[model samples]
Every structure is written in C-alpha cells, then in structure tokens.
Target: MCMKHRKLLTAGIGLLLTVILIALVRLVDAAPIGAQGTSIGLSHLNQFVFDLFGVNMLWYNITDWLGVAAVLTGFVFAVTGLVQLIKRRSLLKVDREILALGGLYIVVIGLYLFFENVIINYRPIIMPDNTSPEASFPSSHTMLVCVIMGSAAMLINRYIRNKPLNRILRAVCYVIIGVTVVGRLIAGVHWFTDILGGILISVTLLSLYEEVISHGK
Candidate 1:
C-alpha cells in the first residue's frame, strides 16, 4: 500500500484499540473493587498485575522524575518551533513539520485533560502524596513521553543531517520510551490496561500527525 494509505490504516487501528479500551474500562468499573466503589480495572489482568508487583517506591520515583524530563523535552520542542517562527516571520517558513509537531503536542495535552477529567479512572494504588484519585487509563506519562520523544525522533530523522547524531538521538528516544513504559507498569500504581490505552492513543495521534505533515509537504 501507499504511505498515506498505510498511515490511515494504522491510525484507524489505533483509534479502534482506544475505543475498545474505554469499553473495557467501563465494564471493569461496573464491578467495583470495594465498598468505596473504586473501579478495579480490566477484570482479567488487573489482579495479576497488582499481585505481580505489589508496590515499588523506587520505580514510582524513577518514573515520576523521568516523566518530568519528558515534559520538559516537549516544552523545548515547542520553544524551538516558536523561535523558528519568530526568526522566519512566517509560520509557513518555520517548517511545516515543526508546526505539526506543536499541533500534535496540543492534541496530546487535550486528550490528557479530557480523559483525566471526563472519563475518570483512578489509579490502582493511590499514593499518599497525591490529593485526588487521578485518572489512570491512558497513562499521561506514557502518552506524553511517547509522543514528545517519538516526535523528537521523527524530527531528528528529517532534519538532523548528521547521521551519527541522528542515530544517537533515535536510540535515546527509544530507551526513554521503553524505560518509562516499563517503569510505569512495574511501579504497579496503574493498571495494565492504562498503559495499553496510552500506547494506543499515542500511536493514533502520531500516525495522524505524520500523515498530515507528509501531505502538507
């Protein structure tokens, strides 16, 4: 299939997975875990995941710090785009791909807010430090790191003419994404489905971003 067709197909699959995940969450929520009516999570795997890794303060700390780094990286990219726009004095001249990257970040943030506020899925284990039972489905950390770092890799491939440096950047992105995802899972604070949902949403958003940017060029 053509590149555009492939991207469209992949985007569709990603969105489908996200919808299915939502349905699964609702199903799980119907069966509350305790008298408090706290949503349990994906019925089959939630228990297994919790039992496998009771709780790891170290993993929690690692994931939290790494997540902050990812957010900062996203801000850096946004600032880079704004700087380019300022220097060029034209949004079109600032690199259409970078604009698309900014748009992608906005979309990711919007989704984060919508999911967290509208479709609340409390974390599997609430930390004492946290004030509220923040939504866990479609993990914000995994989604943000995946999109921001994933976009960084794409930008590096497209613009960073230095082959060695490009390779290094790509490797670093891969390592960060892997560690963040695994760390969140191993931390045992979020349900397995939450991680899965994040992966799906990230894939969908990235695929759509790539398709739009490719066509713009």
Candidate 2:
C-alpha cells in the first residue's frame, strides 16, 4: 500500500482503539471506587493497579514538570513560527511544518479542555489542595507528553542538518515521553485505562500530524 493509505489506516486504527477502550471502561466493572467514593469506570482493574503501585507524589510531580517541559518545547516552535512570519511578512511564507505543529498543538489543547469538562473518572487519590477527586481519564499529562514529544521527534530530522545532534534530540524526546508515561502510571494518579486512552489518542493525533508534514516535504 502507499504511504498515504498506510497513514490513514493507522490513524483509523488508533481512533477505533480509543473508542473501544472508552466503551470497555464504561461497561466493565465500573463502580464508585475512586477517591472520596467518586464513580470510576473499570473500577475493578483500576483499583487493582492503584493498589499495586500505590500513590507516589514525587513521581506525579516529576511527570507533571516533564509535561510542562514538553509544552515549552512546543512553545519554542510557536515562537519560531511567529518569528518567521514577522521576517517574511507573510504567514504563508512561514515554515509549513511549524505551522502544522501549531495546528496540532491547538487540537491537543482543545482535547485537554474537552476532557477537563467531561468527567470519565476521577483520580485514584485526591490531589493536594483539591478537596475532591479531579478528572483523570485519558491522563492529560501522558497525552501531552506523548503528542508533543512524539511530534517534535518526527519533525527534528527535517530541520536539523547535524545527524548526531538530530539523533540526540530525538532520543531525548523519546526518553521524556517514556518517563512521563511510565511515571504517570507508577504515580497511581490515573487508572490503567486512562493511560491506555491517552496513548491511543496520541497515536491518532501523531499519525495525522505525520501525514500533514509528509505532504509538505
């Protein structure tokens, strides 16, 4: 199959997986097992994982900071795009990959806001300073880290001429993504299903981003 077809197929699979995951979380063993007795989807499995790992505030904070770093990386790209626009005096003259990255970031932010308002399940434990459990489904931190770093890794090769430097940057992005995903899980802030959901959505978004950037090349 052609590359375009493959990209679409991969994106479709990711979306399908995300839909199936959400369905299972809602239908299977869901109960009021979350913090302060909030209802949680996939309560049985979520409870099991939470019990096994327990809560680690240190890991939670670490991953949270890493997520911030990912966002800052995206911010750097946004600034680059803006600088290009000002120098070229035309938005169309700005780097297409950077423009595409900007669009992807907006979508990521939209998803984050959407999930914040729509409660799927609450955190396993109440966060500090919060009187009650907050929405934990899709693990926003995991999603943010994966999408931002994953896309950055993909784009780095296009912009960086130094092969060794490009490799190092890509490696760093992968490491940060790995640490955030695993740390979030180990921190016990989100259910297993939440982590899985975040991963699936990231896959979908990243696939689309790849397709767009490929067309520009």
For this target, which candidate reaches the highest TM-score against the unseen true structure? 2
In model 1, where do residues sit more than 4 Å from their true spots? 28-30, 34-37
Ten residues in sequence with the least summed lDDT for candidate 2:
38-47
What alpha-carbon RMSD in Å does predicted model 1 have with respect to the real structure?
Answer: 1.9
Q: Residue-wise lDDT of candidate 2 within 95-176, one digit each (tens)?
A: 8889989899899899999989987778888888889789988888899999999999998988898999999999999999
Q: For residues 16-45, could you state the per-residue lDDT of candidate 1 as single tens digits?
A: 989987887786544564113576656557
TM-score of 1: 0.92
CA-lDDT, candidates in order:
0.82, 0.90
Which residues of candidate 2, in runs, are more than 4 Å off?
none
